[model samples]
Target: MDSNNTNVKSNADTILIVDDHPSNLQVLFALLESYGFRVLAVQNGENALKIANSILPDLILLDILMPGIDGFEVCRLLKAKSETQHIPVIFLTALSETVNKVKGFEMGGIDYVTKPIEHRELLARIQTHLTLKKMSFSLACQNEKLQQEVYARTRVERQQALVGKITEKIRDSLDETQILQTVTEELVKVLNTDSCQIELYDEKLTMATVVYEYIKEDSKEAPREHLRYHGKVRQVIEPIYQQLLKKIPLQFVSTSLDSKYTKLACPIFENGGSKGILGNLWLLKPSEAVFEELEVQLVQQVASQCAIAIRQARLYEASQQQVKELEKLNRLKDDFLKTISHELRSPMSSMQLAMQTLEKLLQSDYPHYKSPKFARVLEIFTSSARRHNRLIENLLMLCYLDVKSEVFTSELINLQIFIPEIIQSFSARIQQQQQHLLIDLPEHLPLLSSHAASLEHIVVELLTNACKYTGPGETIGLQARVTDQAIELSVTNSGVVIPEKEQHRIFDQFYRIPDNDPWQHGGTGLGLTLVKKMVEVIGASLELESYKGQTKFTIKLPNHHCTLS
Candidate 1:
């Protein structure tokens, strides 16, 4: 072939030219070469087919008359084959007859040129076919891209459906084991993996256990091979676990699997305050098998739901244990209180009987019965004993209320009559304090439905507190009235004001107000606490307000009516 290899603007569009005449090849090659085309020239049809198949050129120029296979035959063979069929073909012929030109077009020749060729016509025809070829190639590429996008969107929809199933499973129950098992099973199906395992870590991070595991029955790998409990396999998980400790998500090619298999893990996280990675969702696959990015992302999403379920179940179990412990302690305290109270009462009764006998003897036969000095000592002894007895009774009452062991039977008590009786019981103390006592008693105060014994104790505690706290000549008042909603009873004292912060704890057993010294007040501190519990048992509310040098304790009895009698 005649050759002139000169620099032409390179579009790199390769055109394969076939003709029996070397002159024709030379002229056409030079004409196409100067036009920025990459030209490959062959003088015979056999070589044309070979080069076309090998190079798969963008366009082919073939002469109709050749030795072994004619140009029509060459185009026919190219069209028949899969690899070279897309190439555009143009036939060259010297014959001007319409029949031969028609024959060329029928044989899959895209265009034809009369030979002793017009260089310009040949060039123009070549340019037209090359443009058409480029446009066809571009269209094919766009079609392929569109198909890929459709496939991607379909995959995402399927993955989302799988996520919906996972969400449903979580909403069904908070059982940790069930949630993990369902997760592993779904992972195997979605990932098309050989096996899956969910490993859990202890709070201290000192230990890891496989909480759930799965293996495909048809998988060739043995169950033991997939287990991480053994030798070097555990080391593979150590780094992933460390990543989880930092709350960072990670995925890496795993070497723990046999060379024939591949493994991947995604961290599972806990729900609440300190969000630590609880464990990992581990997936295994045959080495030749492929796991796409979409599948990996699906596992991560499902893993999140698993974390929440596990955390909830753990917290619930811990709360149950705490509740049981509190109940046991409460029961033990109730038994101890009851036993001690019974033991204390027997000695107290004997002391009271002995004191009475001594008093009887003094009055009847003792010489000091008429002496003032003996009389004073006996009065002091009797006072101390009575106070001690009252303390013991308060303690026993507290024990009953603490465990809800006392059954309260409500009775109708007329407050008009009841209030005066309670005040009369403290008559000696009221006279000795020399404090002005004011009673605003109503004639028709509403009757209270309550346990009478408990109500009596409540009233006495409030009255005693009022008497003790008020200074000499300060006003101490007891008031009773009926309200639209309930019965209101209050005791007020003018001298002492309770501090704000101490009021909250005033109703706690044995909690005396700070600096209200026991020596001065002479109270066991159980008085107010006992009062509160008894008030609650009878369905009443107690309130205390202290401000501007005055304090009032009020009790509102519920409106539940008992028999008027």
Candidate 2:
């Protein structure tokens, strides 16, 4: 044994030696042991075969010309069996004849040493064979690892493609039943399971219904169509369902009375599992072929897609219901408005005519009774009638706007003339409130091609709003200016500031600024809302700015419909 050779050391490499002579065995064993090789010695070929089968050492050294079952026979037997074939064998022989050496080599002996064995030559031969064996094992391990990696990559690719296909099939429809059915069918086909089912829990999660299921024709389990699991079944599966609710996927081998099957349960949830789970996806195979980790992950991905489809279908259903409800409410509202339009207007018109006739009779036939108090009473009666009429008109106008039934006919108009006329109508009310009115219309203002009635209604509502909120001696300003994009018409009032937060909501129907109406100029709150709608109808935009003791409502009429006059 060469001690200086780095490879010859006590590294736990085992070598078995077989020789009939005890002296030869002892000498060989000592020499190999000193070089740190684990040595096992036997005297005959039969024992050699038995020990080789038991320990399967890294290397074998055999002596030829033994008593029975010679070295050639031992090597032949070792080579015949599959388990001990790969162990390297070096034959020790005294006969140096070419014929015997060829016989040994044919029997699977790797190398033969002549009987006057050189100790160093034997050790060197053993080291070479050990190194070769280790190299062979390392190569085999590398090849196996490479094969496993390739298999895993292919499987992942296949899984991803299957997920895409399942997603497409499930999302093809917005109907809940169809979507769930498609999911069950596709999962059964893709997973090759005996059956696939989707069970949806009620909102309370106390009840579950098998809404959709697909079973192979030859499946062992009985078909369960539209089964409602409650009471006993529900209680039995409560633990499993609880795990699913926590978004933990489950795989288990479930045994029935006669057969055992594999089952997988994956939860379906909304909003990336943050929301409550909607249901569970169950897959079953007839045999005890446990679901692999990759298969579980694939099911989870499909479950996420199922969650989205379920949510979308539910949202679509909810929206359809809401639309039907809105349509019904709109019809009722239309009927009420039509009835009020007729019933209220008839009496109001009659009352107006009777009042006019009575006023004429009092003036001509009874001049003595025409006192200031009587005149004041007539004024109150007239104002009350006008307010009631205005309320009715507002309601009808809102109804028309809501249904988009208001017809708009566009015509050219000069704002320089049109705006002032609108202003003049509100002049009497402004004077009565003692509020200052400021007009800022340019001389060469552009002509607007828009719906005259819509524009008039918008201006009137804005001016009315300005009049109602402006305190006595405060200024109400109506200003018009041209910008590169449009004509800007603004109604600004001083000494009254709208809160920033409320400005955005003032245009909402029936909304009012709390405690901001000092004069109790009570209104239906539809004025600004109507204005906003009319502005949109005429293809203009409205904005509000209220700060620093001033509130301004600005309407921008686009320049595309404006011409220099």
Highest TM-score among the candidates is held by which one?
Answer: 2
Worst 10 residues of 2 by lDDT: 227-236
C-alpha lDDT of candidate 1 relative to the true structure:
0.79
lDDT by residue (tens digit), candidate 2, 29-82: 888878787788999999999989998989999888999899999999999999
Candidate 2: clashing pairs of residues: none
TM-score of each: 0.74, 0.76
lDDT against the true structure, each candidate: 0.79, 0.84
Candidate 2 C-alpha error for residue 186, in Å = 4.8
Please report how far candidate 2 places residue 362 from its true position, in Å. 3.9
Reference-based lDDT, residue 541, model 2: 99
